[model samples]
Every structure is written in structure tokens, then in C-alpha cells.
Target: MRTRHVHPRPADPTSTSRRTMFVVLLLCVALGSVLAPGLEPANAIGRTSPAATLPSQDDGSSITWSVRPSPTDADPERPNFGYDIAPGVTVTDSIRVRNYSEETLRLDLYASDAITTSTGALDLLPAGEEPTGVGAWISLDSSELAIAPLEFVDVDFTLTVPADAEPGDHTGGIVTSHRTPGVDDGGDTVILDRRLGNRVHVRVDGPLRPALQISDAEVSYTGSFNPVGTGSMHVTYTVTNTGNVRLGAEQTVTTNGRLFFPGRTVTPEPMGELLPGNSLTFDVDVGEVWPIGRTTATIELTPIPTRDGDVFDADTPVESASVTAPTMPWTLLASLAVLVGVAVLWRRHRRRRERREAALVDAAVREALADTPNASDGSDGSDGSEQDGSEHDEPQHENGDRDRAPDGTGAGVGGAHRSGERRGPPAPRGNEQ
Candidate 1:
């Protein structure tokens, strides 16, 4: 058997850049929910479901055909076609298309350029779109095939590199597809095209530059209500492969609060591979970050060489980007303020209560004195007896005076002197001059 190679599409840089921007926007909107308490990273927003599988029949039957890279002598189990050719050189490859249905099938074979989807997965351009890169370089031996049931056909193709082809990676795919008549939900007739393919990676030998860049970095914090509690620091950024060589990377997110107090350091799983000129958006949440007024987050991407399509050397310097945002502990401050207010209110209440109690005690004492008749009269028991004796003595004197004659020193004068003696010298007058 002759050696055969199957090619897969490579990443399209322009499309990848656009998709990266879109991903950044999406991540920004979903960031709050991602950092919400008690949520898992897997449940983060912006995640998309898997692409729907193309139907193989009008009646919604299972796929009855398949296409993939075929085995070859150079590398029998090679997954896809990979090549390192110099300028003005040509290569050969093959793809196997199998028909597993009960009847024979007709298929159309073609090549298309590769592009990165918005979800960061690889996909091919739609049919009828002209490819300008590896897809245009590849030419298949036959464009149509008729295979019997349970049989497969090996289609050959030629990949010719132009004499002036740029010395880097070029990617495309070898695919087989079929068209079927279908009706849309709007009762309109449509053509349903389903395709399957293998990828091709071609590299022209030349000087390789492997570089990575970090862009649009953003940092935000979500704090807890507890004064001493820890919060989450979210870091988001876009990573772009700006060099000509395919590579991988080691991603790390480091955070620091005021005075360089380390919050959290996150070293996520390393990136396995990244196509040249492609971009990827990353979202990382570092937990247990204490809000210390402000926090700075740094995203560092270290290039890692990939050995899938061609020999790679990622000796470039590490790329880093940073962002800063205020992380004030508002909830904690509010709690402290409430406590202070409560203390002040309690102090005022206590002082008012003490003053009220003092006034009440003073009034009670006044009431007790009023209830006693001699409390402020300044007279004792001896004074009351003296007054009673004086009244009796006065009556006796009057009787004696009446019995005495009307002489110059009669009884009346004697009675007046006796009464004056009993009264104790007329009791010094209160108004005496």
C-alpha cells in the first residue's frame, strides 16, 4: 500500500482575534455571577454547549458514513497529516471515506481553510467559500466518489508550496460531504449539507518566532459582610499568539493588596496547545482575598513549545499584564459604624435615666416632709406644754385683778406684771430696731 497523509485545517488569525474580543465581553458580563459565593467554577457563565451534530438523513437517522486520515508507511498510526517542507516543494496525502449504509452513497470531496470558533474550538469554513491559505494549496485527485455499502475509498491529494510561500505554519482540511433536500420550520425548502474531515498542518522550514502577549487585563473584587472575612479576586485577560510558531503556555494569576500583602496566587492547568496568530480569553478567580483598600492582579503567560505539527522552540521571554482596582471593605465599615451608633445611644439613655431617678428621689423626700405636720414648724414637745400652762395662769390672774380694789397699785397692775413674767419678757420682737 502506498503511503498517504490526511491534512487538518489550521487556525485563522483574523477570526481568532475577533472571537477573542467577543469572549472578553461575554466574560465581563458574567463575572459577577462567577464570583458569587458558594458557586463552583464549572458553573461559571459564558460556557457554551457542544455543537449540534449534523444530521445524515432526512428522517433523522444516525450518521451512516465517516471520514478520517488513513494509515501510511512513514507513520502507520499517524492521526493527521503533518509536514515540514521547504519553499518550492510538494507533498502528498490521503483521506479515507467509508459508507456504512445499506446502499451505495455519493460524496463530494473538497478542502477548506481552518478557523477558530467563538468557543475557541477549531472549525472549517463553510462550503463554497474560497480559501487563501493551505486550502488553496491542496488539490484532490478526484472531487466525486461512489462507494458501495460497507466499503471505503482512499482519495489522494497534492499539497504544493509556492516558491514565495511565507515560512510558517499553514493549515487546512481534507473533507467529504453530501447534500440532502430538507424543509425548514418556516415551510421553506432548503439544502442540508453535512461534512466530516481530518486536519492538515504544514510548516515551511524557516526562522521561528514564538511569542505570547497579554491584553485587556481586568481585576475586580467581591468582598464579604464580615469585617475580618476574606473575599474573591477575579482576574480576566486575553492571550494572543503573536508569533509564527504554534505553542502552549503556563498561565498564572497573582494578586496583592495594599503594602504588597499577598492575597492569593492561582496557577491553573497549563495550556496544552495554541495555534499561531490565535487568541484565547481566560478567567481566573482567586479566593480568600482580604479587601485591603486596593488590590492589584497580574496575569503572567509563559510560552511552552508544542511538538504536534513541527519542532517548536519557545525561548521567548514571559509576557505579563496587570490591572488595579479599589477593594474597600464597605460592609465591614458599615457594621462598625452601626456598633458605634448603638453605643452612643446607650450612653445617652443611661445618663437621662440617672437624672430622672435623681429628680424622683428629691420629690419623694419633699412629699414625706409635707406629710408630717411639724416637719418645718421648728416647735418641740416642751413648747406645746408651755403654751397650755400660760393659758391657765392668764385666767387666774384676771380673777385676782377683779377681786382687787381700784387703787394706784391694784390687782390689775399685779396681774399685768405676772402675765408679762410668764410670757418671758414679751419674746424679743422679730422686727426690733
Candidate 2:
């Protein structure tokens, strides 16, 4: 067996070496691909991650990049532009640019020019571009940037919103340029082609803010201070949202030279929010003023947003309503009028009693005078008395002496019946008529 195998082994040819060489060549190619500096990862489908992980363009050999934003279209649910600010507010945000390439690349950050490629977003038909005097152009930023390959770089910015600024929509962008440094002048070297990207939409915003301002500095009420120097009144304040976006607000109400409602320390401080073009209302209480007089007052208003939202505000003074204090004159006058009426009535009652007593005295005097007239009729000359007698009395005749004698004892005793007569007092007679 050994002898037969030895003859076969001698015939070993170069074919085996040829096959080994081919296998070694294949292995070298595979290893070269794995170690290549320019090799890149495969691309993914769709926008599934926060920022698409892509290669950076250095010399434009095989680097890749994309222009991305949080949203590709204007979201009706969330508008692209707006601001929400309250008095004393500051807004802050962060921007991230992620590199997914195998090599380092330079990135230039700037304010994006308002533009899209001709085939990108040029609107037409019903969705055509609006007639804006402003055209879409590139914007430049003074910020600096350099990102390491496969690294995430973060940038931050802040917007200081004024308390008195009107709430509304504001739009802006952040652009990035991928190109070689010191090589941008007309392509001096074999530099990468100009690769530009942008965040087309950015908004400086706050929450829906609502504010309330009283036309009056303070409201009137049955406030503290028992027996207030002046009367009190209450105030109701209504706030209107005049901004294009919602606003979140907080507020405080106070009074100067006046007391708060209920008690000085009991003034209410309200906090809330309001939608855009909406209004809010509140009430305030103020104590009375001095002099029991009427007056007007103005209120100072300061409103601010709690979050990023739109709002409108004027730090100037705003007038509310006419204020009036209680007066003592009318009340005192009413009491005085009542007292005067009582006095007049008492005086009239006293005069009526006096007139009644005078009438009674006059009636008594007339009776006494009538009795004296009878006495005068009896005492006066007979003729005067008889003529002045009442109409009911009979007239005296010439036989008066005979009638008188008939009552006497001697002459006509037989003819005359016993009858008695009494003499009366004389009546008043005219003097030597």
C-alpha cells in the first residue's frame, strides 16, 4: 500500500497551488472592503428616526446628507410660526445635527434663506404661492460649527420676549452648509459640491396667555373700614385675546390710595389662560374714598405668557368706568326736609286750636249781649222797648191803663179774673232820637 501511494504523491502538480492562490485573492478583496476608509452603511427607508442618520460630504466622493425638519409640511394642528410671551419672559430651545458618516466633515450653521428648489415646493393651482413682496432667498448666520463624523452636535438659542409686545405668529429657519473650509471661493480645490440643508420652520412661542385689566384702578365694595369715609363699589374686569395665537397668562390686581375689598390684605389675585381672540373677565373690590364724593380712576395692566404662545398687551394705562362715592348732603337733606314738614304741621295744629277757643268765646259773648238787650227793653221808655220787641210780641193798645186797673182791687173786680203780671227790665233806647 505504501509503495502504490508514493507513486501517486510524486505526481502532485501546480493545480492545487493555483486553487490556493485564487482563494487567497478572494480573501484579500473581502478584507480590503471591510477596512476601506470610504465604505458607508446602507440607507434606511422613510423618516423613522428623529434625524436621519446619513453620511457627511467631505470631498463629495461618497458622503450623503439630507435636509430635514420636524415636519415637512405646515401642520394645521401646530402652526409653523407663533410666539407666546408674558411680562418678564425668556424662551429657550436646542437644535441637534447628527452625523452618520464614517469620516469627519465641516458644517456651517446659519439663518436659512427662505427658499425651496424649483422642483421642491413651488406651489401652483389653488395652493399657489401667495403674493408676498418677500422672496425666498438664502439666509446667513454668524454662528460657527464643526461636527465629528458619527456624532451628534447640539446648538442652543434663546429668545427674550417683551412683556408689552403684541402676541402673534413669527417664522424663521436654521440652515446648514456642508463644504470644505477655506475652499469655498469658486471651487479652488477638489472640494465637495455645495450641500445645503435647512429646518424650514421655527417658532418662538408660549402657551395661551390671558390677561384682565380693570378700567378702574380699584372697585367699590362694602369694604373694610366700618362706616367708610365714602361709599363703595365693585368692579368687574373682562380681558380680550386679540392675538393670532393662544396665550397663557397670570395677573394681579391692586389699588392705590384705596383699601382692598373686605380687608386690605384680602385682595384677590387671579391666574389663568385664554385662547387667541378670546376674552376673560374678573371682579375686584375697593374700599370707599374720602369727602363722600364721586371720582374716576385708571388701572395699569401687565400681562405675560406662561409658555410659548401669542398675546397682545399694552403696558399703558387703561380706564374702566365712572366711580362715585356716597354723599352726606342728600341724606342730610332728606332728614332736614322731614323735620321741616313736622314743624309746619305742628304749627298749623296749634293755630287751629286757638281759632276754636276764640269761636267759643264769641258765642258766649253774643248770648250775654242778647240777655242785656232784654234788660234794656224792659228799662227803656215803654214805646222804645215795645217797638224794638221781637216780632212774636203783641203791640200795646190805649186801653193799657184799663187793662192794668182790672187787676186792681176796687173798680173792675167783678169783671176781671185774678191774673198776675210781672214788670221787665227796660231795653236800650235811642238817645233823643
Candidate 3:
């Protein structure tokens, strides 16, 4: 040591132990500052937590949380927050989030559009999907939030319907999610996210059309050979929602004769929910006694209101379609065939009877002609006077008989005598001269 005043070795300011102590104090202070506010008794928060519960990844314990519309909000049902707004208008709403867990929790908040699943159940879009409808129109005050143990927070959001927004029911949700730390599964770190939300039903006021159409109505009949027997009938049709609003349908399929007389009525299962531009094909099997011949199959569709607080009216518009199908009556066809065959047989019998009667008449005429006396025979004069009279009429009678008989001996005899007259009886040149 220098004999002159040796200042005590200044305490080493850069020592490793001192630096370590400083870092530890800093960490303790930071942790205390973060946890001190939440450590105060839960009752000091002055808000009631929701009854909803969520399961945690650590030890399978449960965490209770909920998102609901603020108490003063319109249509403040817990999970369904509905609003009726006009186009080119802006509306503000708040949702209350509650945490009942013993430890503080952080949540990621977002807005997403609602969708119907393939099974026709309502659901929300997955994270990272681009929002297009109601989700795009919403803006939140806070995108992230932290809640103390047994504490609740209310989040305010603004919804701005564009001037071109479609006039109908648009659905979306306000979602809050908690992402758990990554876990090693199959050499891959998988992070699980749990989410809860309140559904937002926004109805933009404008002209709303409610319409339904029944199309492609077809009826097929498979008939038995026996016309009186029952057969199978199938009716197929398509139901389309052509309007901008959702609708449910009560369908009635009927079969009627010319004057709409009741034949068969079949009421299938109600058409549940039909969204805009959606179509459904239905096939119904109806069994009844279908009258033989043409019948009309008519489909009548009455729309059932799907929205809440709707009044039923008797004059509701109904859509109808019809198709004509023919049922063949084999019995009538067979009877017609039988009648045709009887007529043919009766015609043949009548012709045979006429031919037999003509043959008998011809035979009787020929016998009467053979029994007549021949007035040209030279015989005794006992009946000379009568014979003379008969001979005198015989020539005239022979000419008449020849004209009547197409083939007879009288015509041949008359022809020979005419030839003799032409030769003047051979001029009597025989030895009789």
C-alpha cells in the first residue's frame, strides 16, 4: 500500500454476484406489480361472473367463463344478441365476458360470420378464415383482453351496415378464445384453443321477399293386371326457396280426378329450414286405390314462418304444381276383345244360314219344274182340249222359264227349234214328201 492516504478499494461495482442480485430484485418487482392488482379480494371487482364452464388442459380442471349481451342491450338473450338496423346506419353494442377461474386468464377476441354446416346445424367460421358478410362489418374496441380471477369485463363493439348490404337476416358472432401452451404429440407441438362466443343476428331493414316454388312434379304408377287391384304410386318434386328470407314448408301431395275430387293425400315430413336460393328434392310413396284412367297429382306448398314472433295468416301465399298420370284398366280391354270375337262368330253364322236357305229353295223349284206336264208331247185326245190349252201356253211359259233359269233343258230345246226354223225344216226333203 502506498504510504500516502490509500483510498479503500472501492467496492467492486461490476461483480457478478451484485449483478445477479440486481436482476433478481428487478424480476421480483415486475412480478409483484403484475400480480398485486389481481390479488385483491374477488368481491372488489363488483361484477357477477357467467355460469358457463370450459375445460382446461392442465389436470383436466374446468374454467368457467361466458360471453353475453350487456344487460341494457336490446334482445339481450344470453347467447343470442339480435339487432334490427337499417342500411347506411351504424349501431353500437356491448358483450359481457366473465371469468370464474381461480387464476387470471388472457383471451383473444375476434368477430366471425356464422354458417350452416353440412348437417344443417348453425356454427361459426374457423380462425384465420377471411370474413365476408356480417363479420366484415364489425369493429371491436379491444382485440385482446385480460381478466382477473373471478372478474368480468364488458367489451364494446360497433357494427356499420354498408349502403349495399343485402336486406335479410345476417348472422355473426363475437368470439373469445384461450390458447393453451404447446404440447409434444408425435414429435409435433400441438396447441389447443378453446373458444366461446355470443351470436349476433343483424337484420338490415329493406324490402324482403318471401317466396317458394314447386317444380319438376312427376307421378309414376305401377298398376296390377287386374284393374280393381291396388298398385304403387310414386310422386317426386323439387322445393325451391326463391326469396331472400328463410322459410319452412308444410307440403301436401294430392291426387284428384277431373273435378278435384279427393283421391289420395300424402303429407310428408315438414321441410325444415330453407335458406335463400336453396332447393330440396323429395320423393313420396303413396298407396291408395287409384281410379283407372288419367288422374292429376298436385303438390301444394304452404310456407311456414321461420323467424321468432311471427303471426300466421290464412291468406299466406301458396305455390302449387301438378302432373297427370294414366292408369290402364286391363279388365275393360279384355271385355272389348270378348265382344269383338262374339260379333265375328255371329256374322259367320248368319252367312251360313242364308246359304242353306237358298240351297233348299233352289231344290224345291227344280222338283216342281220336273213334275209339270210337257204340252209338246203328242198323246190321246181324252184331255185334248186341256192339252191344247196347255200346249198353247207352253211356248210362252218355256220362254219365261228360260229367262229365269240360267241353266235348264227348256232353253236348249228352244234354241234347237229356232235353228230348225232358220233352215225351214230342211225343206221337207226327206222321204216323208
lDDT of 2 by residue, 1-433 (tens): 0000111122123322455445443443343344323322111112122332222222222333333432223442232223344534655444455554445556655542233222222111111233121112222222555555455554654544444544443323454554322222233322222324333222234443343334323344442333434444466656554554334344444333424422222244543444344455666554443323333333334555534433356652332333443423344456679899999999999999999999999999998987765663456555543222233232334443222343454342113223343334322232322
Q: Residues 325-373, candidate 3: write the lDDT tens digits.
A: 8866556567778899999999999999999999999999999999988
By lDDT, is 1 or 2 better?
Answer: 1
What's the residue-level lDDT of 147 in candidate 2? 54
Report backbone clashes per prediction: 8, 47, 0
Ranking by TM-score: 1, 3, 2
Poorest 10 consecutive residues of model 1 by lDDT?
Answer: 42-51
Q: What is the C-alpha lDDT of each candidate?
A: 0.67, 0.39, 0.65
Give a tens-digit lDDT track for model 1, residues 227-290: 8788888888888888887678888888875564556789987864666778888889999887
TM-score of each: 0.66, 0.29, 0.51
Weakest ten-residue segment in model 3 by summed lDDT? 40-49
Give the least accurate 10-residue stretch of model 2, judged by summed lDDT: 1-10
lDDT of 2: 0.39
